[model samples]
Target chain A: MEWFGANSFNFEFVSSVLQINNIQKSYGSVRALNGVSLQVPEGSVYGILGPNGSGKTTLLGILMSVLRAQHGSFDWFDGRYGDGYRKKIGCLLETPNFYQYLSGEENLRITVSISERGDEADIERVLKLVGLYERRKHRFATYSLGMKQRLAIGAALLGNPGVLVLDEPTNGLDPVGIAEIRDLIRSLRQAGHTIVIASHLLDEVEKVCTHVAILKKGNVLTDGPVTDVLMDEDVVELDATDREGLRSFLLTQSLTLETDKETGWIRLRFPKGQAKLEELNRTCMQQGIALTHLSLRRKKLETRFFELTND
Target chain B: MKIAPLLYTEWLKVRRYWAFWGIFALVLIAYPGISYLFYTGYQDIRSSNNKMDAMLKLMVGSPFGFPEVWHTLAYIASFLVFIPGVLVIMLITNEYQYRTQRQNILDGWKRDEFLWAKFWVVAALSILLTIVYALVVLVTGFVNPDMALAGIEVKSYYIGLFALITFNQLTIAFLFGFLLKRALLALGFFLFYFLIPENILIQLSRWRWHTGNWYHYLPMEASDRLIPPPPYLGEITNPADYKQMLQAIPEHILISVAYTGLFWLFCFWWLRRRDLT
Candidate 1:
């Protein structure tokens, strides 16, 4: 339960940073979102995990007001935000949609104007935060894809918005660029900004996101702490002295186990906190199968993700 | 007031844009520069002794000298419609092309603010173009030998109409830019609308449809009528005829006003109705 920061810390006094009601969106015949609702507590790095066209981008678009949802509504900071809510929320949607001809600094100046914040100091600070201060003078079009994405992060950091919404922040980036952005998001979360990231890369979410919602085909299959959901299964690797007897015993038992003949291991999963090593051995002894090798193996989110999404 | 930052945002977008500076330079030169050339040419012709030259000098007597200065400046400035049209198209269409329109709204701008940013740019361009023409008129009058301070008229109404016509033309460009959202397509339609469509439609209204005087009320033609062709070539030199030619007809002015309002209505509607996808 402590996998999410919510359990470790008392957030009762800290209001919900984002509350999405039963929001829905459609594009022609395709339903991009179908009455999706979620609440994001303050100071959480919430990752939205889904395959492409699973309504992740569409959801972010509706939240940012870039695209109107056909049904339902969402509120920011428990309805504390009004017309000026955008000044407190920074978003990078899909691409680094900056003016190609203008320098990064000039583009941020436009952002400053739109946000109506008078702090010119934050421009340099945000640029430095994204490691783009050196290239702030370069035209956006001249920069590589990684540099463009960095500048976009810098733009979103302007005015010190309380929340950041990023859609596929690592899209089209090299490994190093993805890591840089990942580190940036981690630091921003450490600094107490409520960050929301929509991504399909499972490992990226597992590494950085404290909470996650798995979406498939415009519907959220499940949502909770990443550790709580993905770690629901504890994999036990076992082999017995009577291999054929172990196989038949495993088949007769109510437990589900995946047997790999080449590795001479059958992997069985128990609910978290309920996988007792002695209990498993006792079951094998009663079946007249002596255990030769038994150990715990790391369970991968990739396996669980396929299991959940494929369903 | 709240629009200041929005204007600043728009200025940053276009301050370094090539089309911005290009059209700006073109308007600065085409208005005053052409006025200077016409003034010097009039002076040269006035000094000639040939019979045709003498008649021409009387016909175009000191195009920049007193009374004639205001009309001359406004007329030359009207030729600037196409340049600002192109500039306005670039300003509005660049948002769509770059996808900054979505970013701008996400940053805190209401959809109306996005439209106003472009509106203010058009308004500023019209005012600047009008003022440039005013300065050129004053300078042309100041340097002309036949210029008389006593006879000089500010012709504020004429200048106002000139600015209005410029706004009308720029709005036409804005409408097309919003409707098409493609620079080339918008510019092409802009060129065709102003250059060919108006003339052909007017001709058809006269020859084929035989609609008496109805063509002048058409949007582009109404703006064109705001600044009528300048009096040259020994035609309509009489005081009564000259005064009539110098002022825009009230009917045409009313039509231009209606079209200007309608143009903005369509632009705002487009901004509101369309998704910023």
Candidate 2:
């Protein structure tokens, strides 16, 4: 349950912030979502990861109640809030939707008024938080794509809602803007707000999300803590004059989970913290196969994602 | 939410929008401006020295005077309802254009709440139109030198009839904007329907098909009939025909109210059922 390592804060009791059940939707013969379900834990940054047309937006739309589900239901905060649950949840679905003629400050005012959560003072704080305080009076249509995206984040941050559901929060942002949003999300997590983000960027998800659900073709291929879903395994590569002998010898070892033969090396997979480079070198030499190359590397999430998606 | 906040939110949106203010300004000017022109033209005919002009004035009487001014202004102002009707369409379609309708629901508003807020706006605009009509009637009646205010109580209900006509027209515009979801398409189709199609259908029903009183019940036509053209013009040409037109004002009011309610209900149903995407 405690997926984060030593640096992570411990939650004495984890609760579900959002529980989605078998939500299905379609558009004129295209099945956008096929019974997709997932739960977002309280105080955790959850990522819904998928490629374009993989139903990430569709699922978020349904959960936000902007788009109706064909058959299924989702509960927020255990339905304790009734019809007022949305006020507790701030969401930015797909593109940054705002009145083009209204300034950023003016737009967030409407948002604040509708949510009935925050006030004019909170609006100032959020505008500054998203670094749009200076341009707050500028019309949304005049802002750059990055600025528009940031203003949207600023709007979502209003009222200081307990949960923030963002679709591609880092979209249209430059490298620095992306990093700033990541740090902001981390800071928000530290403040005990649960965040649900839908993104196709593996790097973004891997860096910021504690938990992720990988979706493909309207189906969830894998979902869990990032550490578990990515399969934390150490890969050891070995090359020897007698490749066949090294391969046979490594296949016999108990630490080797799987071995893959490459052009000039044999790749050995082992569970995390189980790869012993010195022992493998010594054993290979004793087996009369002198190793030419010996190295170890951890498997990347990108690799794991590709393996799961088979794309 | 409550009605005050709902209307306030709508005000926040349009307070800075020049298009909204521009259309509203046009309404304020044109509503009374056109009525004033008709009043002056009738005054000119009344003061003419020619025998025929004097005789014609006798037949028509003073349309700008007390009781007649209400009906006269209502008929003239109804022609300009399209000004505010365009405003309603633009406001509704702006949501679809910007996709803020979905964002409103996403932020916290129930789908019905968002729509009800707009319905209140329509109601407010209708009331404003009625007030303008009343002011025009009062100013025109009081300014006419030969007119007496004694008959002011007669046909005072035309003010409410004016409001119903505007409400029905605006609700129909709301339907167009909601269904089309695009400003140009909705406005174009609305104008085409209001200007040409509905008129043609009404004429065809009356002249070609000889459907008695059926044409009066058409959506916009029902409201149009609530305030028939200056009864004097009908009196001068055909007294019996014009007299027959006034008999159906009650029925026209009922049909107009029903159409307004039905249009609003249809919009509510569509908004609740269709995906805001």
Candidate 3:
């Protein structure tokens, strides 16, 4: 109360533009969103990474209020979602469901018309936005995967919403498509719109997401700034014939090593802010150890995900 | 202005199906066409008793809210229910059939808006059907100046009855459509019911068990209002109350209202509770 305009850490500037508090959904015996709590800060690119059937879609569905939260609450601070909040949010959740018989322009017209946004001008604006103005006259069925995905994005952008929620916005795209969508996400983020994406594509998330949440088996294992999660771990790797000798030496020296029998590769983890990887490499070489491969690793999301969920 | 978007969406949904246009044309033309044909049958059952005919022949200019108006509207629009019923099915059931409803939900419409958008479609149809009835009647007046033009009974009552008929037809369409997501299946069952089985059942209701009265509760019951009382309707009427019953010009009006209200109420209940996955 004392600092009404001040932004703190919890009540931080992005405390939560959109907050889901302790949501729990159970289908008879199957729990979906198990005690899930998340805060989507305003004007941030947030990614939710999970495997198939990991409850990403369910979470988005609940956010759009398509599926009601059986045991929790979702609050949106930027708009009036209490009754008419859906109007403010745009989404591209699944495969495009346009009238396949109609041309892209006609379909866009119908969608925008029904959307109750601007008039014919909005349709032209979206077609131009997706870079599909030339193919706007083609039927949606004839468009390629990239075009369809772009059109879906264009549809989500039809009303120029403050938040755009996309599920695998580039699931089937090639490198070019991925790059284009990444650029689009960047532009969207730059425009100060909140963008939340649920994707299985790690590199895509790594490139575009400012914050991320990981889910495995319907549980939100971890969520925070991407930089913080990625920068937390200090690890290194080595491939040596005397792996056993190296493990024994590392154990004696209070270092942790995990070996992969299939690849015969050994990974070593050390405490944070301690950069003694060069010293360790020097010791291995000086001891006449045949070091095949040597490298240091940051705490990547993949590592953190496996660390948290592998058990 | 906002309603335009809602109405625009309704138009987009309806324009895709040939059934909407085809059946609408059929209803718009069928009533007046049949009425003109009935003009040829004027002498066959023309009442001989001047007083009875004067009372029952349909007064043309008795003040607006007369019993005569409802009787005429009931007679004229009786055979028209089937068209609107099919339209209702097209309007509501198509969403479920094509997964458009779910997509619509994702496109930012709530379950209530979905329901409300559909209700607007039915309301729009009712207005169209009424205008067609008026047009046909108006054209018939040009062809035969002597034709009766008893005004619609109770403007407010007619409006309510209009709402009732629209709601009832859409609900029947909705109930069957909600259960089956296939357009062909919805259409096929609708055709089958309207054909031999339903007609035979109507006949059997009189000779079979007393439960035949429940026919009025079936989808056919509301549609039956579209067709005028058959010339031989008196054969099934009770001899004791025939005269008194025929005087009640507003027959079937209450049933239309009751049926529409119940359907709208039930649809909302089902929509709220059902899983949309």
Highest lDDT against the true fold, candidate: 2
Q: Report the C-alpha lDDT of model 2 over B1-277, residue by residue, as the tens digit.
A: 4899999999989988887898899999998899888877776766676886678657767678888888888888898888898999999999999999998998899999999999999999999989988988888888887578789879889988998999999998889998999999999999888899879988888789887767777898888888888877767677888888888789888999898898888888888888888
Best by TM-score: 2
Q: What is the full ranking by DockQ, best candidate first?
A: 2, 1, 3
**Model 1 Cα lDDT, one tens digit per residue, A1-311:** 01012212212234688889899888899999998988898888899988778889889888888788889999886666575677777888898888888998888888888876525787887778777889989888898888888888778877666688988888778897788778877877776778899988888887888888888888888887777777776778899877888988888877787876789688888878777888889988987889998886644667778888885
Q: Is candidate 1 or candidate 3 better by TM-score?
A: 1
Off by over 4 Å in 2: A1-14, A232-267, A271-298, B50-53
Candidate 1: which pairs clash?
none
* Residue lDDT tens for model 3, B1-277: 2555677777775565466788878877776676666644542334456765465446333211233334344455655566667766676666665456766777767687777777677777777766665555455444543444453223324434444555566566666665666766876676566565766776688577546456654555544553334333432456444443334425565666666667777877877766566
What TM-score goes with each of the models?
Answer: 0.87, 0.90, 0.78
Candidate number with the higher TM-score (1 or 2): 2
- Supply the DockQ value of model 2: 0.71
> Can you tell me which runs of candidate 3 are displaced by over 4 Å?
A1-15, A113-119, A141-145, A236-268, A273-296, A307-311, B14-23, B36-77, B145-167, B192-205, B210-241, B244-251
lDDT winner between 2 and 3, please give it: 2
Model 1, chain B: what is the TM-score?
0.89
Identify the CAPRI category of the predicted complex in candidate 2.
medium
DockQ, cand. 1: 0.64
